[model samples]
Target chain A: MSTLKIEDYDRLRSKLPNRTGGWVPGTAVYCRGYDMMDDLVGRVDFFQSLVLNITGQLPEERFAKWLHAAHICVSWPDPRIWCNQIGAYAAMARATVNAASSFGNLAADSVMYGQGTLPIGTRLIQRLHTQHLNEKKSVEEIVDQEIERKGGKVNIMGFARPLASGDERVVAMRRTAKNLAYQDGAHMQLALAIEELLYNRYSETMNFTGYLCAFMSDLGYSAEQVHRIFALIVVNGVTASFSEEAEKPVDSFLPLRCEDIEYTGPAKRALPDMTDE
Target chain B: MVNRSVKSRKEPFVKKASTNIWQEQPVEHNPYLVEKTHLRGYDFDELTQHCDFTEMFYLLFLGELPNRNQKQLLQLLLVTFISPSPRHPASRSAMSLGGGKTFPQHILPASLGIAGGEYLGGRQVQLCMQLIQDNHQIIPALWLEEQEARLAEADKALLAEGRIIYGFGQQYGEIDPYASLLADKFLGKSFSGPHLTWCAGLVEELKPYCIGWLQTGIVAAVLCDLGFPPHAGAGLFQLIQAPGLLAHGLEAYPKSRTEFPFVRDEDYDIVDT
Candidate 1:
C-alpha cells in the first residue's frame, strides 16, 4: 500500500500551487516577483524577460544580447532546412500563421537535430564537464571514452553534425560572444579542449549546440534550463520561411509529381476474403 | 579556423522519399494528379468496400491486416480509451482552447501537444513500451526483488509526489482501477502475448507497493503484443485518443468561455519560493 493519504490529493482540489506569478485581473500582472507592467515592460529586453520567465532569474543585459545573437545564428530563413520546410508547406496549405509557426516548431522537436537535441547535447556536455573537473579525466580520455561508448564511431553529439563537417554557426557565435566581452569559463575551456582534440584527429569541430551549452553551463544553467531557454530558438526562421511562402501563390512550394515518391511495397494484389481467414 | 575546411559530409540522402505503405499512380494527362492509390498493395477501392477501419488501421501501421483476435482486441482497446477522461490535462486544453474560440485548426495540435507530455500521456506509453520490452523476460517477483532498492527510493518520492515507474504507479493517491479493467478486456484473449502476460505478473508483484498497471502500461503491452515498435507507441496512442480530443474540442467550440470554470484569484495560490 501507498504511504500517501487521500489528503495529498485533497489538499489542492480547486487550488493551483503556482511558483511563478499570475495576474489579479484588475490590479497588476506579476512575473518572477516583478510587476509585468511596472517593472518589466520597458525596463528589460524581451530576451531578458524570456530568461526571467524560464529560469526565474533575470539574466544580465549583455548575456541576453548574446542569446539574441545566438538565436539569429540557428534560425536562418532557409526552407531547405527540415523545420522551415514544414513552415513553408503549412503556408502553402493556407494554414494560419500561428498554425504554420506552431507546426514548424513541433517539427523541430526531433531527436536528430534542431531544438530536440538541446537536452541531449546539454546532458552530454555537462557529463563530460563533470568527468573533466571532478574525476580529473583528461580531455583525450573523455573523447576516447565517448567514441568507445559509441563503438568507436566518433559520433559524439557536439562534435559531429548532420550533413556538414564543420558548423558555421559556432564561428558566428564565437564572434558574438567576443563582441559581448564574454570570456570562456571552465565549461567553455573544457569544450574547446575536446573540440581541438576532435578537430586535430578526426576533422570534426564543435557545433553551435556545443558552444551554447558550454557557455550557458558556465553561467550556472542546468541541462533542463538550457533546453527550456532555447526551446523556440528556431521559431523566427520558421516564421520567416512561412511568411515568404504565405505571400506567394498557394501550392507552389516544392509541388511534387506522383512519381516523386517511390513506392517500394509489394506489387498490386487482390484483397483476401473477409470470412476466409 | 580549423585545419580542415567546412564542407558537406555528402551523406547519401535519397533523391525521392520511398514508402512501403502507400503508392499513388499518376494520371496519363497530368503527373501531378493521382489516377489511383493502393495501400499495402491492396486496392483503395477494394479496401474501402471490404475492410473495416480497425483492419485498415492495423494494415496501415503493420503493413498487414490484423488476425481475428487482433481486430477484436484493437477494437475493444479503441473503445475503452476513446477519450482520456475530461479531467485529463489534454482534454482540459482542448476544452479551454475550444471554449476560448481559438481557431478550430489550432485545437487538435494544442491538445495533442499537451497529450504528448511524459506524465500519463503518449510519452508514458512510449516509455512503458520500452520498459515492458526491456524487463518482461525475467520473472516478475524476481524482477521486483532485483529492483527493490530503486523501488524503495521511488516510493519516497511517490508519497511526496507521485512517481510512475515507467507507466505503473498511483494516480491521485490510489491504484488506477480502470487500468486493470482495461487490461482485463484482453488478458486471456488469444491475441494476448507474453508482454501482456509478463505485465500481469508484474502487476501482481506490485500489489504490495500499491503500484499497478497504468492505462499507458496496458496500451504499451497491447501495442507490444500487436508488434508495434516502441517509437510508434506515442503516435499510436495519440492517434487512438484523437477522436475524443477533437470531439470534445469541437463540442466546446460554440459554448461561452464561461461555461467552464476558470480558477479565481484566491484559488490561484502563488507561493513564494
Candidate 2:
C-alpha cells in the first residue's frame, strides 16, 4: 500500500511552488534572493545573472568574463556545423526567428556534441582527477582503462574531436584563462597530463569539451550545473546562420535537386490487390 | 602561435543520402523533378487507390499491410488515446502555446516534446518497453516481488514521492481508472499478443500495491505486440498522440490570452532558499 495520502497531491492542486524568485506586483522581483530590479539590473553582467539563476549563487566577475569568452569560442557563425545547419534550414523554410533559434538549440542537445556532452565529459574528468590524485593512479593507466571501457577504441569523450583532431578552441580558451589570471588547478593539470599522453601515443589531443570540463570542474561545478550553464551556448551561431538565410529567398539555403537524394529501395513494383477492403 | 593545427580527418561521408523507405523516380527530361514514387516497393498511386489509411500507415512502418486483426487493434488503440485529457500537461502546454499566440507550426513540436517527456509520456513508454523486453522471461509475480524488495531498500520518503516503475503506477495515489479500463479493452481484442497478455498478468500482480497499467504501459504493450523495437516506442507514442495535441492547440489558437488561467501571483508561493 502507498504511504502517500491524497491530500499530499491535493495541496498542490491550484498552487505553484517555486524555489526561485517571482514578481510581487507593486513591490519587486526576486531571483535567487537577489532583487532583480535593485541588485541585478544594470549591475551584473548577463553571464553572472545566468550563473546565479542556474547555480543559485552569483559568480565572480572574472568567472563571468571567462564564460563570455567560452561562449564566443563555441558560437562560430558557420552553418556547416549541425546545430547551425538546422537554423539555416529553419530560415529557408521561413520559420520565425525564435522558432529557428529554439529548434537549432534543441538539435544541439545531442550526444555527439554541444551541451549534451558536458555532463558526461564533466563526470569523466572529475572521476579521473580523483583516481589520479587521491588513488595515485598514473595517467597512462587511466588512459588505458578509459580506452578499454570504450571497447579498445580511442574514443574518450573529452579527449578527441570529431571532424579535426586538436581543438583550436582549447588553445584560444587557454590564452583567455591565462589573461584572466587563472592558474592550473589539479583537475586542469590532470587533463593536461592525459592530453600529453594521448597526443604522444595516439596522435589525438584534448578538445574544447576537455578544456571546459577541466576548467569548470576545478571551479567546483557539478556535471549537471555545467550542462545547464551551457544549454544555449550555440544560440548566437544559430541566430547568425538563421538571419543570413532568412534574408535571402525562400528555399535557397541549399537547394537540392530531386536526384540529390539516392533511393536504394526495390525497383518499381505493383501493389497487391487490397484484401482488407 | 597555437601549436595544434586543425586538419580534416577526411571521414568518408556519402555524397547523396540514401533511403530504403522511399524511392522517387526522376522525370526523364529534368532530373530535378520527380515523376513517380514507391514506398517499400508499393507504387504510390496503387496504394492510394486500393488501401485504407490504416493499411497504408501500417505498410509505411512495418513494411507490409497489417492483417485484419492487426488493423483493428491498431485502429482501436488510436481511437482509445485520440486525445489526452485536457488536464494533461501536454494538452495544457498546447493550449497555453495556442493562447499565447505562438507560431501555429511551433505548437505541435512544443506539445509533442512535453508528450515525449519522462512522466506519463513517450519516454516512460520507451522505458516500459525496455523493461518488458528485458524481463518478460521472469514470472510476473516474481518480478513484482523483486520490485517490492528494491523499493523497500529505497528511501521511503523518495518512494512515496512518486518513484514509479515506468509503465505501471498509481496516479493521484490511486490506480488510474481509465488506464485500467483501457487495459481490459485491449486485452479482450483478438490481436492482443503475448506481450500484452504478459503485461495484463503483471497488472494483476500489482493490484495489492495500488499500482496498475498506466497509459504509457498500454501503449508500450500494444507497440511491442505490433513488432516495434523498444527504441521506436517513444517516437511512436508521440506520433500516435500528435493529432490530439494539434487539435487542442488549434482549438485554442483563436482564443484570447486570458482564456487560459495564468495562476494569479497570490496562488504562487516562492520559498526562499
Best by DockQ: 1
Task: For model 1, report the TM-score of its A chain.
Answer: 0.96
User: Which run of 10 residues does model 2 chain B get worst, by summed lDDT?
Assistant: B155-164
Docking quality of model 1: it rates as medium
- Write the residue-wise lDDT of candidate 1 on A1-277 in tens digits: 4555688667777789787899878988988888899999999999999999998899899998998898888998999999999889989999988887888988888877887887888888889989888999999999999999999898887777888888888888888889989999998999888989998898899987788888888888888888888988899989999999999998799888989999999899999889865
Error of 2 at B117 (Å): 1.2
Docking class of 2: medium
Judging by TM-score against the true structure, name the best candidate: 1
Colliding residue pairs in candidate 1: none
B181-246 per-residue lDDT for model 2 (tens digits):
888888966788888998999989877766778899999999888888999988889888989999
- Residue A82 Cα positional deviation in candidate 1, in Å, after optimal superposition: 0.7
